[model samples]
Target: MSAAPVIVIGSGLAGLMTALTLAPMPVVLVTAGRLGQAGSSPLAQGGVAAAIGVDDDTSLHLADTLAAGDGLCDAASAREIVGRGRDAIMALESHGVRFDRKPDGSYALGLEAAHSRHRIVHVDGDATGAGIVKALVAKVRETASITILEDCRALRLIKRDDRVVGVCLEGKGPVAARAVVLATGGAGGLYEATTTPLGNLGQGAALAGRVGARLADMEFVQFHPTALAVSAPRLPLISEAVRGEGAILINDRGERFMADQPGQELAPRDVVARAIAAEIDAGRKVYLDARAALGEGFVRRFPGIFALCQEHGIDPARMPIPVRPATHYHMGGIAADCDGRTNVPGLWAVGEAACTGLHGANRLASNSLLEAAVMGLNAGRAIASEMTAATVRLEPVSLPQMSDPAPVRAIVSRGLGILRHETGLRAAICALLPKAGHDDAAAVALAMAVAAFARCESRGSHARTDYPHKNASGTRKLFTMDEAFAFARELAASQPLSRTA
Candidate 1:
């Protein structure tokens, strides 16, 4: 008998790329919403980072990535992933993605934040994600061997013996598969203010955790410094490429707050975000001033951003754009290897959902798309080579309850914002622990709280007001759901009622 189709969950860039790379192999692509319309991939404003520039090299790119990661990046993994820049670009292009190029037919590279060189490969100016998704979605639709399931949410993994054989969909019981690949993006939606799709409530982590997969770096959530400071659940990202093009961060009093900081407006995301958060905390409104740098050219350079500004009744050429920090990315997720292999056999994770250690604590601007594509392609190849046809009787499994982040949003937002402390973290844990066993969102939030509380020093994106310095030594944290619950229970039992309340 032929091998069962591989079940790939979530239809973001990673999921789409995985299915496409699988090609003639039978595959099932499941998405919570319509393909291409769901997940954080379509909302990514910054393009992919690749060391394809004439003056740039993979070593240079790796240096910037490591620097941004603070002190915890896995050097070997970062090296291998960054070294595949050229190959990833070529692969994307072959899959119908048309990156923006200069008149000389060279890839048009844009610099962002800490990158020492100009190496961001975008498409359609500021609409990079949208453009790339449009192309890939087209390619996926035409592929003969892939079956696309729209509006289907995968709630849990169906593990038999020591391996994950398939996933239990929300309404569709257990569908058997040779392997299960989770490309379910990040957990940014747990926060009230975020740049990711609201549905991204760490579903991948929750699924993997329930099945005993290890999650690493759960506390390192990257907050973008310039999400449009609008009153919306999901803030629109202003793109770090804007700052890369010479925009400056200014307060309502017209002070260039980041001027004296290292690297200034082009500093690492953690620095910029903290600066912005400080300004907001002090009752000041921060704005991105693109007037002197881009001016009239802003419309041509960032047409999508220009349109978004116009919709909000602001003109980037004339006035500064209102900006603030918002939960932008998650550096922590289901612990996986370079090839997206989890400790659990027959299960894999990619994109923002997998902690491959390429992005240790903080992700370099635009490196997300690169990692997603690379890891997705790598996972596809690995699965194809290792998968085998086997006949196993399917056993009945109960579908998990659909997750709702609403209950845990306020707690998570307060405890795990740009700045964290023991008090807030413990309070969040105390509240989330009670609901975690039944609520997937609460379970994911509890894990993040536990991890954040355990990490005693400030490092990268995980800033702690109480512990204001980086530790002399730090390592990536790996914990299963049970371990997190055990820690939470112990902490809760020891804390006084007054303190927890």
Candidate 2:
């Protein structure tokens, strides 16, 4: 907002990349916390997914990407990213990201769930995200054209009919621009246990929907299979790459129960997470047995996780880790092209914020970090081409007044979180309708409902018990706020009233 020509919402990998790639363009990067603090970029342990290896062709990578997407991916989008992945990685290297290399000096690659080959280019052995973000942050700091603003939160998009002229801020004043890019991360905060930062509450997606940006796959939120559950509220996440490195999932009896998927110890996150959930549901505690797998390098490779586990009296060097399926990534978002351009003009979305269709129903292991870096660059470059001479307007719009959302949050957290059913969803809708105040949170709730109602099939991460069909629903689904509400109404009207109530 603060009188900048271009404004970015969050300061994660996506926001920083957007600012950096469009160099010499007047850009303002806003963050709810410090630049590297908010969003999941820093916490990412796995590396970027790219076709950097000799044997791994772009076509092969594309095939893996689409296969993981589960028949809902845009073929053109998948092809575009795979083709341009090497260039994006090279850009990261130019920005000072030091990737791990093999003995002969080639880049080290690792395998993850559902990938046909090992192509995850890590920075640190385990903390790949932290290292890459650190480099990018340093690069952004020295850029004269980029203005990084800390402690500012974005409220919503300022729309003049269809185009987004600017965005409203929570504390700071509005900064008008010809174009706005929403790099503001995902909706993990909507859940009880999340690996993402507290700021990631689906604000970007909500902002897009409020402005009528065509959103897809909102129901397909990718839940991390190995987030550690403890006495805390938002559980700390254990990286999937740990499992990629041979960490085994074991029940209380120390029996490995994830043989259903190939590479028993390391399967796709959804499969492993469901396996862990089923293990817990069957009256047994589940743990990630990293002691035998990681051995001595466990602490060195993943110091953050090692320290966290040690804090809870469970050393990864000697014992297994407590894990559960927690909200991780939203596969659905403001639908955008490869260049991060959305349906609406003067607006773009990148990183986890944009549904680029790269991640279809389920995101393969490290593809998230890969998509953020790749798409972030594409969005920034695209934004730089227009509107240098346009009139800049920075009008102050009043922030939306917020009421207590505890009741609504409770209802959503209980009824809408994790596994869902039609009966519980209807009850949740009835309970929240009265309390759906004029707030950003309610707008986000509406966005969730838009895709939730459209897809009756329980495909990918969004599980619907009442309609438990797993096959594809043939046509792509989309819904507006009115339509989502109408579905709720239709469901409510059909159910008979309770006799004793």
Candidate 3:
């Protein structure tokens, strides 16, 4: 007659992995849409990064991750997550994930940008995410201990005496439990141009922030360089693997501009994104030209991207694919340790919702999937060890009503997109603070603006036009709602005139 022992508020790789790891234990898994349709997991085209190649090891993977993080990565956490990469891959394989294999019966390792070794483990070529998610969904469906709450959405976390006791759903009402795991993904959906699922509005982080949870690295959002520029709500991603396979970036003048950069098209994501942004800002069109590189094999190798291009009326084999920088991933979230334990007792966060310091400023290509699987397993085991027989207490909880997401998306796109300036950031906060009055989406946007403004210098994904140089201090930022509001108020009070007004 007791409620489920644990409740996971996501359906992505992290949520499913956590549910599977805690086998034989009753857990309720909630999703806003059908299991795999509303998250970034199924949209992942680059596959997962693991040092499973004969020529590679964890040390080299650690080095690549640290370098891409741009000095903000927690070295210990990075080492821990990357160290578990092979084991995570093996575990996924055991769960029925069929990774692409070579003729010799070995894994077909891939090369992605910022990685020195060919270590990406994929499935069906570019449909890696779909393959992995399909396998997990099938396995989870077979598990009797796990209850699926299809179309049920979590509005907020219910806390009592500084401990999270339950989550309030939008329609079904409150479901209390001994433990609440927030596996909700990133805030990229807050922006107009983004590659994340539309449901990913940072609800989990907003819920945590409302209850005074610590958030870290909220300023660092990685902008992927090759999001297809089209008039659509969901931006299709031209995978980084395309570049790794020898694609070149060209400007409107038919020039290979990336040739001047050291890494060419295979540079770190931040560099490539900025370069593409620069070209776009200079009134020159930027395109991902794989015509001479991948050629006809593009359709066979990357059927997902090829289909997306064809649907948009472009062919990668014949013409250049239009590309631009768009909000891709967030390297920041609720400040949690490697085990997904947040400061709030009885509450844990995993996946992109939890900032475990594995990704510093920018995430390396294909590492998000790896981090999700590895960290989800660790958190599941940790939560399993701390389970108790405490009775579930369901209670009536009032939730905040969020305003239309249009205004927040516009402000974020202008100020927090790829390039930022001091004046624009301050203006963005002033506009956003008033709208954040009980709106969870606006509050998440405010948190990001506050953190972005607080960090005076540019680092990795957080680029500033005014303070164009990196600060000498390599300190990480941690913030709360009060701190962010305080900074926003102070900033508004200092400015005599408001550009947003």
Best-performing candidate as measured by lDDT: 1
Candidate 3, residues 1-501, lDDT tens digits: the string is: 564568998989999998898877888999889987779999999899999899999999999999999999999999999999988998898889999999999998889999999999999999888999999999999999899998888887888888898888878788777788889999999999999876688888898998889999999999999999998887999999999899999998999999989889999999999999989988999999999998999998888899999999999999999999889999999999888899999889999999999899999999899989987798889988984746566688777885789888999898897888878888789889987868888898999998998899989999999889998876899988878888888888987445354
Model 1 scores a TM of: 0.98
Quote each prediction's TM-score. 0.98, 0.93, 0.98
Two-way TM-score contest, 1 vs 2, winner = 1
Each candidate's clash count: 0, 0, 0
Please tell me which model should have the higher lDDT, number 1 or number 2. Answer: 1
Instruction: Return the top candidate by TM-score.
Output: 1
Give candidate 2's TM-score. Answer: 0.93
Model 2 agreement with the true structure over 276-338: per-residue lDDT tens digits: 778888889988888877888898777878888888888888888888888888888888888
**Candidate 1 deviant stretches above 4 angstroms:** 497-501
**Candidates ranked by lDDT, best first?**
1, 3, 2
Candidate 1 residues 1-501, lDDT tens each? 667899999888899999999889999999999989999888878799999898999999999999999989999989988998898899989999999999999989999999999999999898888888899999999999999999998877888898998877777877888989999999998999998888889999999999999999999999999999988778889999999999999999999999999899999999999999899999999999999999999999999999999998999999999999999899999999889999999999999999999989899999999999999889999999984857456767766565566879999998899999888998999999989998999999999999999999999999999999999999999999999999999999997436434
Models, CA RMSD each: 1.1, 2.6, 1.3
**TM-score computed on alpha carbons, candidate 3:** 0.98
lDDT of each: 0.92, 0.77, 0.89
Clashing pairs in model 3, backbone N/Cα/C closer than 3 A: none
